[model samples]
Target chain A: MHTDLVAALDIGGTKIAGALVDGHGRILLRAQRATPAQEDGDTVMRAVEDVLGELTVSPLWSGARAVGIGSAGPVDASAGTVSPVNVPGWRGYPLVEGVRRATGGLPVELIGDGVAITAAEHWQGAARGHDNALCMVVSTGVGGGLVLNGQLHPGPTGNAGHIGHISVDLDGDACPCGSRGCVERIASGPNIARRALDAGWRPGPDGDTTAAAVGEAARAGDPVAVASFERAAQALAAGIAATATLVEIDIAVIGGGVAKAGEVLFAPLRRALADYATLSFVQRLTVAPALMGTDAGLVGAAAAALTRRNSATAAGV
Target chain B: MHTDLVAALDIGGTKIAGALVDGHGRILLRAQRATPAQEDGDTVMRAVEDVLGELTVSPLWSGARAVGIGSAGPVDASAGTVSPVNVPGWRGYPLVEGVRRATGGLPVELIGDGVAITAAEHWQGAARGHDNALCMVVSTGVGGGLVLNGQLHPGPTGNAGHIGHISVDLDGDACPCGSRGCVERIASGPNIARRALDAGWRPGPDGDTTAAAVGEAARAGDPVAVASFERAAQALAAGIAATATLVEIDIAVIGGGVAKAGEVLFAPLRRALADYATLSFVQRLTVAPALMGTDAGLVGAAAAALTRRNSATAAGV
Candidate 1:
């Protein structure tokens, strides 16, 4: 009855990672496999099974009484399914059932990858100790999750804090999600680089055309690059402020590639936040960079599994 | 003891109302008085006490177990103070302590008026049975509250869902709240009327330039008035979609003066929602008019008090 470890899986288009994590979040064992994202559903499930197979054979797996999954969404926690946009072959994949079968009927908890990252931040990273917060990953695409009332609010379908899709401009630009003026349409790393390129900011001799290169140009005082970042910052500020105005969050933690731009992103974001977070209760909101790094998804999955086990135990289930 | 009733107070700029409400949300006895909003702090407190006095004098008062106050914010449930914007004379007034002293020390619960109305909607009105919903009032100002995981989300300051001030158009227009293009600035009844008039819509022979008049004109095929309502609908849709995307609400219930515009607003709102709420998870979101009437504030306050009483009882307090 010394069940102090949880099994965790981080499934995305790029990889399928599994781990056995201890009570303090240390990974006792870890395994990963490249995802054949374009393959059939069964093939993807097999890769996931292979990764889990690695962890399951380890002695530490015996202590893992429950399993948690952080999968690319849109995830339907109610239906125990996921249909990640980047993985076209896995439409409505029954991930929870697959994982449960692979793990000898261990209780499996599934959440969107963004929600998983938020759980990590809330449990041990930038959002730690904050009762109400928003944790975001601004990369090639922007994604996020919310921590409300000292708990991770993954929502019914496990995609509660998808802030990137929320319209901040209402009429600015069309997003692939079929929405107009979405934060992702204007604020994602790809969009920032695109805006910079469109605004006549050429890449250096290396001919790199990514947001990271644009960040360099911005640091060197390139007006077009700086303006692009400023626009992205504005969109982010509006979205973050809107979140705070709606839910009264006190902090927003940003991670991912775009957030690595540091003060080039933070300075303008702080300025634009004042313009949008004007309501009295929301005026004191702050923003910080996320600290959980690349292992957030794995650790957050373990955290979710632990929380489920604890709650079930408390309820005498 | 037969402690099944709660005292409810609805404090606003225009009125101070009180009621003795049964566990079933029915108002058994009521009292009301005009709010001398411009008067000093003590005067406002006296008006509230007078309303409470009427409820306390009734023979049913002995059955009231607790008190709930739903006041125009910014009300700080944590600090037990309220500083309603329209009531400048009562800056940071300790209304909770005042009510506590007046009610002979009955345990009290305080919430923003928007939260109170949401509680009413969730408990007995349009949002009944929906675990996750946003209830909004779209009259002189747009205000809202959220129901998440089957409980009211009033936030730490009792002002979580102040969606009116959220910027839908971050750079469009200056708002009194210092935000640009806030939902209230574009969608409130006053703004709707102003937009109609500014766009060359004239009043009828009655010479009334209210939003109600504009609604009548739009119904009569006046393009200017119709266009203004459409604009307001667009802003509302963006804000509503943002709420759904961030929190995964299944329904949005709208009430108050402007909602009386009916199809003139709802038609365009539904169309715009289809445009903004495009994510797979949010696509199923529905919009409805609120069923609770003016008594929502009172009923919702009672609902909060009853919930508090029940939780306290469960905790054996």
Candidate 2:
């Protein structure tokens, strides 16, 4: 009557989250700690351990078979290390080894956060029934992952489907990542707000000048605000179309802060997609909002662990 | 000992070529016929049958175990049909069925010509040791194929790596493929010549106005010619970078006429790649000229047939 479970962790600059997830992806226990991102490597490790410490104490811990970590990248899944840009202290940090030790040498799997989200969507969200798909997050930065031939394709470095940084405009403005006119440069939340501000769209009485505010203004019929969102949509469409052309995906699932703007983003995005996704095979590609919400990373990490265990068992390894 | 061989057919607008290939990839025998491209579908198919008939009459015919067809696309490997743009008479033609019948009901496998070339590259050419790669042909048109996880990824319809039609410059000139600023629209051999001519670079007195002549002019220090090649390289860089970013390829193997321009095309391609492929995982991507010669399609088709037969045997199907 006992059910198998996996321990899952979602590590990002802002926080470290841990959960005990069952076979059906139900979270049985949860714990979290704010990331000491600005501190030294050891301090950040302490935060991750604190989150794991709480999970280990639960009576349900003994049922867990493995641990999965979905961390902000570039993570070296091959080398079991991470060097997140925002968390300078964690450069080349031995995250997998650290987590493995804390959990009594349980097997560990690590992937980029974007890939983890894609796994979650492919498992039980907008991309559930699709065999080939691209799932994306359009928050402060645009990050993404691919599901190819019905399996999550976390490339050798665990960073396939990093769509945000792909150049859509070869001669456009320079991005912080040392590229020009990347999708993230034009479609990320910050970029949307910045473009609107640069085009003379001012904040309201509350003085909030976020991308969300720009979305609101566009919904209220502000031409400059509308123009900024339209531009972001164009970049996203170009990137998405390029992905489909390369890998033959049938659907693109989008999430994160910018995607929450709903029709304000989706309408322009769909229209622009028609212009770029003109190939017969890609002409039928559909874009949909992601359904997993905030728990996607944790759930996806759990999915990765479960799938790995199943595959190994099936192979009699 | 009787060695098992595979019959491979490379069907194009101008020719229908057949080969009997050994396990070691050597072409043991060959046959070819001029394609009746402008004739009715039945007539074009008759040319293909004639090439196969010659192969069948060979004393070594009894050694052939399977057949593979690499034809101009878009081909539906699943539906066993083909609709190549250049062969207007073959729209939705039952190509696989016809070949199957022609070869005495031998098991047949079909793939697009681009995918076939990629199979050759992965099996024995420039892409040979790389696990994930993109192989492209930049001739009168741009076409390509992908190898992911060390296997040829001929997507559902056998056209996963059709990179030519993906828009790189969203606002640039329209392409015949219904997309704007496709890699082919700017980087194909004909486009390279057209761009150079439009920029006021005239051909030599020999009146040979091909992209090769333009390459010679650029090597001789014609600024306009160099600029046109540079522009083509820029667009190619964008498309190649996009492929690597989306799929995490470590190498891109380029073939065909434009790739033959040597450093005049490569110098700019490598430099422009630096501008677009800025991500840590993709920054190390290497560009190499394809090593496979004109027989790539036939050799690749043979490779596909051999691989398919091996896979089927291993599965005990």
Give the candidate number with the greatest TM-score: 1
Give the 10-residue window scoring lowest on summed lDDT in candidate 1 chain B: B1-10
Q: Compared with the real two-chain complex, what DockQ does model 1 have?
A: 0.88
What are the per-residue Cα lDDT tens digits for candidate 2 across A1-317?
A: 23679999999999999999999899999999999999999999999999999999999998999998999999888899999998999989999999999999998999999999999999989999899999999999999999998999998888899999888887889999998889999999999999999999999999999999999999999999999999999999999999998888999999999999999999999999999998777888999999998999999999999988889888997
Cα deviation of B311, candidate 1, in Å: 1.1
Candidate 1 backbone collisions, by pair: none
Highest lDDT against the true fold, candidate? 1
Listed per prediction, chain B TM-scores read 0.99, 0.98
- Give the alpha carbon lDDT tens digit for every residue of B1-317 in model 1: 54699999999999999999999998999999999999999999999999999988988999999999999999989899999999999888999999999999999999999999999999999999999999999999999999999999999999988989888887789999988989999999999999988889989888999999999999999999999999999999999999999999999999999999999999999999999998889999999999999999999999999998999999999
Candidate 1 is graded, for docking, as high
In angstroms, the error of model 1 at A25 is 0.8
Cα shift from native, residue A46, model 1 (Å): 0.5
